[model samples]
Target chain A: MNLWRLPRLRAGALAVWRRNILVWRKLFVPALLMNFGEPVLYLLGLGFGLGHFVGDMSGMPYLAFLASGIIASSAMTTASFEGMYSVFTRMVPQKTYEAILATPLEVDDILAGEMLWCATKSLFSGIAILAVATLLGVVAGWQALWVLPVVFLIGLCFAGPAMIMSSLASNYDFFNYYFVLVITPMFILCGVFYPISTLPAVAQGAVQLLPLTHAVMLTRSLVAGAELTQPVLHITVLAVYAAISYYIAVILVRRKLLV
Target chain B: MWFPPDWPGLSHSNFNRHAITFYNAGSMDTVENEVMAADAPTIRARGLCKQFADRKAVDGIDFDVYPGKCFGFVGPNGAGKTTTLRMAMGLTPLSGGTLTVFGQSIADHASAVRRRVGIVPQADNLDPDFSVEENLYIYASFFALPRAQVEARIDALLAFMSLGDRRRAKTTTLSGGMQRRLTIARALINAPELIVLDEPTTGLDPQARHVIWGRLNELKSRGKTLLLTTHYMEEAERLCDELIIMDHGRILAQGPPRELIERHVEPEVIEVRGEEGAALQELVASSGCRQERMDTSLYCYSRDAAPLIESLKGLHGLKFVHRPTGLEDVFLRLTGRELRDQ
Candidate 1:
């Protein structure tokens, strides 16, 4: 009758993470192709095509301006897809979660492992974009190395909410709405393509409220070698997302996996 | 690493606190001595209940599975067999009452309890992406087993399950029987003191079923405790030393297979199937042979079958089969012939 029991996180989650990695390794090439393909196309198409007209935005070429946003959004998309689509497949269609539950691993362990894998996959996509942008001479200095850990934190932020969605998913069809409504809007409105300043004053305020916007702000400032005015606030917002969503994900996934 | 000194179900065995050592702490001779020396059951359920919204999946069932023995939950589909097995493994939470594994309350220390127990679920949920050996390796990691130790055991387990030939094969490519065997091998990675198999051979062919049954018997002889659930009467009769027959989420009968069969069913059974089944039923009735009818067949049970067979032979156009009565009759008598679906 007690339905509000919180999950207990334990060391067993690493095993679940290890299992996903073992399986993911078998198809690394295809995964890498998917991870790198989209961001590269966006960087080339949008940065070059759009940069032709938008010459300089507050002091930098549009390409450099867009590179950091690409890194942040890549982390968001990779972690979101990994958490929503991949985790759903493993939980429902494959029944992999049930198999893991049969062992000593609890549901919290399973969720933690999933989030870790999502973050790992995010690192793959984010670092790939960072490498490509660095080759194009968009990265200002070694201070841009700080973006790696930030990307991972962004991954955790988006993966948490995505896992919450996955816990409620009954079938693959449920994800279409999530992608179209939630993820697509974040991709376009979170300063990924253009500065929030271009939008109306109220719309800029709204954009700042999105987690991706905060990630983009940190990634852009750090990658541009520009001094951040409110670095702690940006990091605090993303950290809050990561922490709160993780707790919610654990509770939701436990209800889904345990009966 | 602390085990409660007064663990409820272990009855003063001198095994180490770590459950992993419970299986390997002593030799076969020592295990046999302990099996005889130990008085407590490895698993015990007292009025355990599991309610899902409105339905009672496991309704206040009580039973004990002794050490170094095979215990079975036998019932037809949706008879709560799987639920009871899940409850025992702590996979499903008990809605009411007490259930313990390794003498420890599962709700209080599920991970510790699960550390000493292995489970083969009703469906084979093997990682389709991994090869047979890789599946075993990853599963071993959940128990925190050392790489060298699990690697050594993986070789023996693969051979024992007759899966050595397919060690490198993708789990998806394996046959149903092979997948089932691989699952069993994966469950053994921890060298668990108790193994719970939920319908271990539900869908296998006769040969595959017999092969699995043989391996399960071998495990038992080596002093491992086993808990399994199945609807197959023959499987229950062959594999279980003690069992409980369940239906509608309740235990309807409990005893050893042979004892329950003797108690419920007559020693003999004769089947009459033909256009003349009614006449055969009448003859069986007049001869005082207990009989039940289904569709176009009549089942007659009696203390002896010679008279029943003799009476059936004179009835033209009627075919009859005479055989010894077994657990199936007991199951039918207790759970009935009505279809059960959930």
Candidate 2:
């Protein structure tokens, strides 16, 4: 492919973003109340209410620590929601990919467009949760600004592999196994609500293998204004995963669309 | 004014004024007319072929589609008609040969070629998410047309397809015929020079098919090129300037429908449906008409059918009808009755 094709890819990406915005506008209010409300309720009930006995966690306020974890987890959730559900439906049930391929656009354009759309959704969802966390006085300093971009990167990282899975999935029932076996375990073991060190040494090592673990760790470090030393390592790990996953997604899309 | 020798109105002038005016007018007319008359073929294909694994779908075929002509591809199922059309539009890769639209190869200039061609697929692939008018607008946007121009074209195409009243209705809400019409309107949004329809009226009722044919004819009158694939012989007869009959990935025949029928089938055909196998054969042989017998029917080919009918009158359990030969007869004569599983 020529480097000059970047403009076309960018245009396609923008088009997908516009389509996502349309879908969001139609389903936004209900989705926001559910996604935002559930986490906030968790914060109020578990963070504040339980903090009276548990006190500070890992030398930080329980609410702040918990808030950062929620932001990271929700970023993954948002990207996965769009990538696994909406993207899968469009690829299979809706047959949208078949229609798009009939145009002058190619498979690479479709993959880039979909990945960008997933990233945008994750970014918005992450920001919404972050703002709520601020109202509760959990965030600190300018590091919060970095949270947005990192969340976007994290969302993109998951989106690439998730899209590949979506393309391969045979039916909606297959997604159930994916969520139950892969996603649920990652959420529990990735230090989303508690420190991973509390788990057994083997379990802690297993958590490190997950992309979400690096994302949650990096996001928590940034939101709480902690030292930046280990955050760089986390960012590197996430970036590697994202690049590899994206390449796989592009290949799968090409095979499916062109063939 | 002084009288001049053999000069009427120009007698008073030193120069012949009409000659100068005529010369200048004729020169300008020729210059303007030359450019307009030089328009070339809008689509051309040479030795185009497509193969799938072990089988060839479309094999080395060549043709030129002049502007404003309704070109038809007539073939039975699995004859490579759709595959050929798809290759022409760059929707499918060509296994061999080349196709050019507006004098440019599709491989080298896809975007430019696609901008001038619109396609209606055999299956309905309408965007179920958008309303009727929105579907047109979004498709136009892919061509990067201006928003104002897109909206204007959407309105015009909707009115042209008689879907103005249902512009805002979701695609799922529309009837099958309505959806097909909307798909046609969508194809016209960019003012394509050539429109390719793959089985456009396959499942439509007779009334709807006629309506679609009317729309296609209207487009033809406006000087738009149409390339369509259909199994309906009557449609090809009614709409096409010329067509090709294909089978087993090869062109069996190509010409005007009537000419193909005349060339391949006799002037009249006597169809015999009965159990009098030996008697029917004897009648055909004695009547001097060439005959072919299938499992259920006997076809007797001749210029005059009355003699064949009279010869067959004594055959027991014989029922027959005589009719003028048609494209169907030509098709049956060439391809036979073997079923092709696509």
Q: How accurate is candidate 1 locally (lDDT)?
A: 0.84
Best by DockQ: 1
Residue pairs in steric clash, candidate 1? none
Every model: iRMSD: 1.8, 2.6
B19-68: candidate 2 lDDT, tens digit per residue? 34434556766643432234345677888888888899988898767677
Clashes of each: 0, 0
lDDT for A117 (candidate 1): 85
B192-215: candidate 1 lDDT, tens digit per residue: 999999999988999999999999
Q: Which stretches of candidate 2 lie over 4 Å from their true place?
A: A1-8, A44-54, A141-143, A197-209, A230-240, B1-41, B274-278, B293-295, B310-319
- Give the share of true interchain contacts found in each model: 0.76, 0.09
Worst 10 residues of 1 chain A by lDDT: A1-10
Q: Give candidates' CA RMSD values in order.
A: 6.1, 9.4
Candidate 2: lDDT of B187?
A: 82
Cα-based lDDT at residue B13, candidate 1: 40
TM-score of 1: 0.92
Winning model by TM-score: 1
